[model samples]
Target: MGELKLSTKIGYGMGDLAGNLLFQMTVIYLLFFYTDVLGISAMAAGIIFLIARLWDAVNDPVMGLLMDRTRSKHGKARVYLLYGSLPLGLATIAMFYAPDLPMGGKVAYAAGTYILWGMLFTLVNIPYSSLTASLTDIPQERTDLSSIRMIFMLIGVIIVSVATEPLVSSFATPSRGYFSVTAIFSLLALFFFLLCFRLTGKAASESRKKDESYKLGEIWPLLLKNRQLLIVTAASLIGNMAVFIRETSAIYYVTYNMGDSGMLPFFLGIVVLSMLAANLMIPLATKKWDKKGTYLIGSAIGVAGSVIFHFIPYDQTALIFLFGALSSFGIAAISTVGWAMIPDTIEYGELVTGKRAEGISYAVYSFSQKLATAVAGITVASVLQWSGYAANIPVQSDQTLRGILSTLTVIPVIFIVLSMGIIRLYAIDRTTYEGILLKLKEKMS
Candidate 1:
């Protein structure tokens, strides 16, 4: 593979920053908005989130198949990003701003628009994910891209963390956090999606694929038969669920368990520090342990953090937060390397199947993420409802506090432990990934 120009790296980095700002914000605040500000019950909110995610499950592979078949001089994947950004942005805003309607009607409105935004997200995200493979087949360049992309993604997460709650308070009634925050982010996302479109240039596919047309039946077999992809996807699904819970529960835990709303910012700041620290370590960690080891070390730390959190006294809020930082340190490394692994797995799929299903591969990957997030949303909301959770209520029952703590401490520990086991099966160590890239380069050249 030829060396990547600085422009290519910088361009891709900038493009991801644009996409992630909306993506991260949606993941962080979407459910919160549905439950707290929308006057929807937590259980109802969970059901809504699950239903929308089911829509993603159906739509993701369809988008993947469509993207795979797409043909343009600019390349198969980049064209969609150019054209699809606007619709995605529009629907994203609309999802949060449906007309004033009855409760059932409002739920239906959110479900319809939310599903539409998700489809639009896949239309762009699957193609965009596959674009990394098109950039340069060099293993090192792939790592560089992943590192920069994840760093920018964290920057976006920090933006959502810092901005969404405050932004909501600024826009509508403080009670309507969901509507206001989503509206604000929708505009912000629109701007960035367009920026992503402008920043990324198209790359010509090296070999014209004979089957650049979607075969509806062939897609599933292609994904299912790839044993390595299956294992990685399983791990990704579980790990991502853990991540969503960690992010989603912080508000409930802080407000109800600790009795302080101000601590949310401090807790998130620890996350920022942890992510920054991980970003700082990327270059050095990759050099020392390579991608696989970095990820293993990360997973180990995550589990350790979960276990430690269980033992921490709830009364000692400050100390518990410090442990939280330790765990986020682990999450940071996973964020950096986990994405890099996805492309590698896709390459492995190509090796085994003699088919380039980058769109399907990335779609399935993102689908797992969506499913995990969806499950997390439903579980958290259901638990909140069952535990007698009420927003800004004068006082939560002891049962509610216990429920929040159990969800925060116990359920996540189970999933993270399972994540570690799945991660252990990921066969594409750094050596194999680099070898795959080298072989691809030689064949292309």
Candidate 2:
């Protein structure tokens, strides 16, 4: 790792808004789109998302492996950003506008294109994820960079969350209008990805071997022993599951639970507000408490909100939104700082093991994220089904309604608490991290 310049870190922050907005659309709405708009059954939608995510899980590691071996004057990861953005957008559009065929046809088409999109996304993401660590060796600087990225990411998420359904609903023809609206929003997402790609250059990257290729066997042991990576990975996996549930369940909670579908934006607006608030305090939080403490505090916020949600009676929109906003604020801490930590953990990995297995470390990290998302999709879908949630039905039974409610409240709460406790066990305080960095710098020099 080289010395980090604050200006470079700020530059990277500029790239996040468009990149995240593109990612959030798929994460938040794909399931809902499949189950309701595309006319797929909820159980079937669950199975499809699970299967697709499983493919994503498998592909992430492989892409991570490939990215390490890639060579270019633009550096290892930037070229993918240059080339992958447009097709990624096209795939997004295709997924929504998939030919209206038989049920199996729709599923097959979705799986094929979505799998490709997932792989492409990984192509962009692994390098993107690995970039923070590669950019600098300083923990505080990394936190600053991460915080900036989170702000832009929130901006992106807010735009999509606030605009997507509302813009679509305004169209006179509901069904076709939805597809067109998604396509346009998706294309705009691509524009942002491209802008992000163009904005970031290889200046922050040090010259490393284009020819040096790493084997998985060597990479695995290094990741296992590189304790910081392990800590962040554990935290990231569960933290991601919590995030996935929040994203995918927003529609359900707003439409069904709150009985005010139009208020979805209002709620999502609160989420954006929380994110904005969190970002404002991030540098102070990280400087004062370090990454581990920040993570724990944020996780606790999520847990408290979830518990509050469970105990509250129906129609407490204010309370539900309040808690949801708080939970999202906590989440902003994780999102901003958590990603920064993964790359920093790579530095920790290099420090302990003398191996710059960025690709392999990031690959497994990538794999873990996909794996968590896969499990999340399966878990949520299965839970929804077991709880008797049925899509396209006019009415639901008490059991089914209770099941849906539980999915929105209890499951996320449990997942968040478990993730928080795990983060508490993470041993990367500021002093420990600085010690590691000092030793690594000594060794490299």
Candidate 3:
């Protein structure tokens, strides 16, 4: 195989940039938008979020099997980027738009659009992520590519986190502002998706031409036998739950506990940027310590920062940002290395089973991630409802404030700690990974 080109790496990165434009908004602002702006209760919003993601959990693997079996001029995974972008963008706009409807209508609208968005998101993201394995078989190259992809992911997060409020304020009211902001994001995301499609098309064409077919019936056993894949999936499920809980609670935490809603983008930007900075250091860290060692250290840092942030007086805004950045840095390290490990597991599966199932492997990972998000959404929403949260109220009860703080900090730390334990069960370290790749190549030859 030839050296991976820089342009291809960047184009691949743009795929995540396109994805996170919609994804970050959902994580950071979608709940807040549903409750505070659209007049839905927080609990209802949370349930809607959970239901949509649960649907995606089922839909993701189906999309993966379809992509794996698809024979197309554009390539299996890349074709979705071409066909799915417009629908995904349109669904995003629909999600943020609030029509003047009765309460029942509003609920239906939110649920319908959100579920549709999740399905469309599955169609695009599973394929895009699967493309990573198709793009290269080299482990180091996959790690480098994952870092590049995550950098763009952070850029997408930063853009939405920092710009949403200001953009909303730029419009006449919050409702109109949300529609306008989502519209802009949708268009930009569409353009980038197309760019990613083109670039990956050039790179994946040869592999797609030689790709082997698998029956739908074959995927289940392949997944069951890939113990490393299962271990990583469990870890990703819990780790992402922690991330979603923390991210979804940020708007609430800033508004009620810190009493400064305007500073949200600034703080969120700090977190994402800190994560971006950590992605830059992944290569060096992985060189010294394997992915598991690096993840252990980073998750430890994240847990410590989260615990410290939980106890700090809510008034210390500067200190809050300080610890938030520290925690985000750790989350970033865990995220980048964790995803880079997936392609390694794909090869491990092929080595064991004598069949390459990159699409199904990534699909399962996506399922775990979406399922975790569902759990997180339900958990946060339930806490808010039971804790007496009143949407759009001028003042929050002390209990509500405590609920937000606990969800934002303590709950997520517990989840991450559990995930670290799961990570310990993952058996593919550097030496194991290299051996798996070598064996797989020899078998293919």
Candidate 4:
């Protein structure tokens, strides 16, 4: 591969920008929409989230295998970006569409659209992620690319965070507001996907051709043997719990616990801005410390912030924002370094297994992320349900507020600690990665 132009970096970043626009919206608001807007119970909404993501357990890898087998002029991964973009956009719109229906009908509708959206998302996301490995073999370049991608992703998050509530409130009803904003976002997502396809062109397919010799049945063993992949996957699964839990619980914390709905945007905005600032520092951090060391630093920061937020009273708004920003800064580091680590693991897998299975590697990683999302959803909902949370209530009970606070703070801290422990076992430093790349080149020669 040649040096990546600045345009190529921005083009690659655009795909994530599009993805986060819809995905961040879901992470932040889907449960709230299902319960408060659609009148579903918290537990039921949680079940919907669980089932939809569990279905991805099957759906994501299938798309991975499909992408691995695809032989198209558009490239193994970019082909999906070209063909899957519009349908994914449509599914995004449908996911937010609230139909007038009975409770059962509402659950059924939510389940169907969400599952469909998840499926299409896999179609695009697995390939999009796989492209990281396909685009470049250089470790430093991959790190740089991942940083640029996170910057765009945070931009998308900031847009959704600051804009969504106001957009929804501007309409006649919350339902209409959500629907309209999603529709507009979906269109914007479509355009960005196309731009990504155009700008990224074809991925390097030489290794992919060699990958064709492996059976689909071999994917499991390959991933299992690639110890780095499993470590990162476990770390991602646990780390995402912290992220999703905070995101899903933020609205409730602001509205019910803090007693101010208007603060939602400012609260989320600070988090996103903190993440953006943290992202800008990732390259510097990675330069000063190895990825693992950088990741551990992030975990420590996140845990500290979570602890501070847990002790601070809800009325102390400035303190809350300051601590939340600290936590989000840590999350940004964890997420950015984690993503850059994946492409390195792809080469590691190739060195161990003698096959490059970027699609399946990323697929399994994506599956773990979705699994984390499912668990976070159910965990948040179940706690709320058990705490006697009621939708549309002017004020929640002390128990319910406690449950919300725990979900936002303490539960996330536990997972962040676990993720740090898992990541500690990762042994792939720069020296090991370089050795793996050298061995792969020798094997190819």
Which one wins on TM-score? 4
lDDT of 3 by residue, 1-445 (tens): 4458899999999999999999888878888888888998877887787677767766877788888778778888888999999999999999999989999899999999999988898899999998878888777788889999999999999999999999999888999999999999999999999999988777788552346477777888899999998988888888888888899898889988888889898989898888999999987787788788888888999999999999889899899999999988997766788788898888888878877787889899987877877787788889999999988786899999999999878899999999999999888877887787677668768
Candidate 1 residue lDDT tens string, 155-237: 76777777766666665575456556656666666666555555556333442344655488888888986777788788778
lDDT of each: 0.74, 0.72, 0.86, 0.88
Whole-structure CA lDDT of model 4 = 0.88
What does the lDDT come to for candidate 1?
A: 0.74
How much RMSD separates candidate 2 from the native structure? Answer: 2.4
Q: Per-prediction count of colliding residue pairs?
A: 1, 0, 0, 0
lDDT of 4 by residue, 125-209 (tens): 9999887887887778888999999999999999998999999999999999999999998888889889988888744443235
Per-model TM-score versus the true fold: 0.91, 0.92, 0.97, 0.98
Query: Once superposed on the true structure, which residue ranges of model 3 sit more than 4 Å away at CA?
Result: 208-212
**201-270 in candidate 2: lDDT tens per residue?**
6544563343335675565677779877787777778778877777777777677666677888888889
C-alpha RMSD of candidate 4: 1.3
Best of the candidates, lDDT: 4
Model 1, position 139: C-alpha lDDT score: 65
Q: What residue pairs clash in candidate 2, if any at all?
A: none
